[model samples]
Target: MEEGIAIRAENICKSFGEGDSYIEVIKNASFTIHKGELIALIAPSGGGKTTLLMMIGCVEEPSSGKIWLGDKQVFADKWLTRETRKIRREKIGFIFQAHYLIPFLNIIDNLTLLPQANKTDDKTARAKARELLKYFDIAEKEKAMPSQLSGGQNQRVAIARALVNEPQIILADEPTAALDMQRSVDVVKMLKQIALEQKVAIIMVTHDERMLPYCDRIMKIEDKTTIFEEQQLQKNSTHSD
Candidate 1:
């Protein structure tokens, strides 16, 4: 793997079912994403943007391809190891439209869950959770239940929870979809901040064009393949120059 590259996908393809019922979602899609970058992935509904994100996140198996996270090859035709759950827990963070915070747990507890499951001491987990809450500007809501916080606040906590594991890659599926325009913009800005400050690679799946400007680059899924928009533009411009 090249230095600073956070994710690399080579000739990736995905399909569902088999024989007559098989449906292909992605094919020959290859791309590299570097650390400290926020990438917007856009496609029409049913266009497999989410599928590509999932494949990179290790939640969905690619029918054929190779995927590398950081410096390690995690998948080649099939997963390199069977411990994908461990891989995800240690390497990837996920955000979704629904915040998915545990309703019964307080904000602090929700954030501490993953660390504690990895055998981190309770005190250490609590301290880490508090630090993340403070970073997200929701320190005061640490003890609040998900119901007590606004949607945006809950989403903040959700983002904090994702970072509790300090993942190298974050796969966000329509994270700002439910928020209003202002809040959506705020969330994307926050994501951009996280990518730069935390030096994590973030792939955000979104349908909203308004959010694209906040990203460092755009990855478009069309015709069952991936395109890096800015790189292509740069290449074209260099030729025309």
Candidate 2:
């Protein structure tokens, strides 16, 4: 991997089952995501978008080929380290379609939970969480529970929680799926700012083509392969299709 490249996947292939029962999802896919960029992952349903993201996030292992995150080669033929959980907690952040915040926990606690599990001191975790909340413009909601906040507020808190761990890569799966167009744009803009300001590479799995303008690059998984497109190229191609 080159300098400042947060993620690099080379000839990655994933499959399930064996023989006649087998199904191949991703094939010979190579891509790189650099720091300070927001990338949009666009694919039809069942196109392996979430599977690829989960593999990069260390939640799933590749069946073949190599994958790297920053300076570490996490997978070659198999996982480089036995402790994927540790790598995941330290190097990756995840956002889902649903906010997935614990209902009984207050916003602050929800944000602090993962960092604390990673052995960060309570003071440090809370301080980082507070800074992120302020950055996302939801500082006043820190004391509120998930049930008490609006959908957008909860999503903001989710973004804050993801950052509290200071992850190098963020994997967001359909983060704006539940929101209206305006709110979706709001979330994507916030993600763009976070990527540029924090220098963290963000891969957002989105079905909404309207949000592509906010991303620095677009990677579409098609025909069992990964096709990369510059934002300008995407404009000339995707919308016309």
Question: What TM-score does each of the candidates earn?
Answer: 0.94, 0.95
Model 1 pairs whose backbones collide? none
Best-matching candidate per TM-score = 2
Report how far off residue 207 is in candidate 2 (Å): 0.6
Q: Give per-residue lDDT, candidate 2, residue 111.
A: 95
lDDT value for candidate 2?
A: 0.89
Q: Once superposed on the true structure, which residue ranges of model 2 sit more than 4 Å away at CA?
A: 232-241
Error of 2 at 113 (Å): 0.5
Q: Each prediction's Cα lDDT score?
A: 0.89, 0.89
Q: How far off is residue 210 in model 2, in Å?
A: 0.5
Provide the lDDT at 220 for model 1: 92
Q: Across residues 1-241, which tens digit of lDDT does each residue of candidate 2 receive? A: 4799999999999998999999999999999899988899999999999889988988888899899999899999899899999998999999999899999999999999998899899999899899988987889989999999999999989988888888999999999999999899889888888887789999999999999987889999999889988885333322232
Off by over 4 Å in 1: 231-241
